[model samples]
Target: MSIRSVITTADEQVPFAAVKERIVQAMCAAGLGAVLLFGAGFSSMETLHNAAHDSRHSAGFPCH
Candidate 1:
C-alpha cells in the first residue's frame, strides 16, 4: 500500500450559516439562564431584607 492510501480523508464539511445559527442559539440559552438565576438571587435577597426589617421593628429598634 502507498503512503497516500494510508491517510484518512474528512468526509463532512460544516457550512458557515449552520455554525453561526448554532452559536447564536447557545448564546441565547446562556443569556436566558443567567437572567433567571439573577432574578432568583434578587428575590431571595429582598426576602431576607424584609425579614430583617420586621425583626428590628418588633424589637423596638429604629432601623432608619
Candidate 2:
C-alpha cells in the first residue's frame, strides 16, 4: 500500500486502539481491586486482613 494509504488506515484505527487500551486498563484495575478487597481482606495474615478491614470501614463499605 502507498505510504499515505497506510497512514490513513492507522489513523482510522486510533479510536479502536484507544478503546482497547481503556478496556485493558479497566480489567487490570478490577483484578487488582479484587485481590486487595477480597484476597487481602480475607487473608490469614493479621496485618493484611486488618488493613483491608480498616480501609473498608473508612470507605463506608460495610464488612459486617
Candidate 3:
C-alpha cells in the first residue's frame, strides 16, 4: 500500500477540538506556574527591565 493510503486507513478516534483544548489548557497551566514562580518582584516596568538587563549582563551579553 502507498503511504497516503496507509495513513488514511489508520484509526482516527480522537477529535481535533479535544486536542486543541488540551493544548490550550496545558499552556495556561504552564503560564500560571511561571507567574507564581517569577511574578513576586515584577510589580513595575523599571524593576522588570533592570532584572532583564542584569540577566543579560550575567550571561555575557551586556547591554551597557
Name the better of 1 and 2 by TM-score.
1
lDDT of 2 at 14: 62
lDDT of 3 at 14: 58
lDDT winner between 1 and 2, please give it: 1
Q: For candidate 3, give the lDDT of residue 44.
A: 81
- C-alpha RMSD by candidate, in order: 12.7, 9.0, 5.9
Instruction: Flag regions of model 3 displaced more than 4 Å.
Output: 1-12, 41-64
Clash list (residue pairs), candidate 3: none
Residue pairs clashing, model 1: none
Q: What residue runs in model 2 are displaced by over 4 Å at the alpha carbon?
A: 1-14, 49-64
Winner by lDDT:
1
Clashes of each: 0, 0, 0
Scanning candidate 2 in windows of ten residues, the lowest lDDT window is: 5-14
Worst 10 residues of 3 by lDDT: 5-14
Write candidate 1's Cα lDDT for 1-64 as tens digits: 9976777568656689999999999999999999977866778777878888999999999999
Q: What lDDT score belongs to each candidate, Candidate 1 first?
A: 0.86, 0.84, 0.82
Ranked candidates (TM-score, high to low) = 1, 2, 3
| Pick by TM-score: 2 or 3, better one | 2
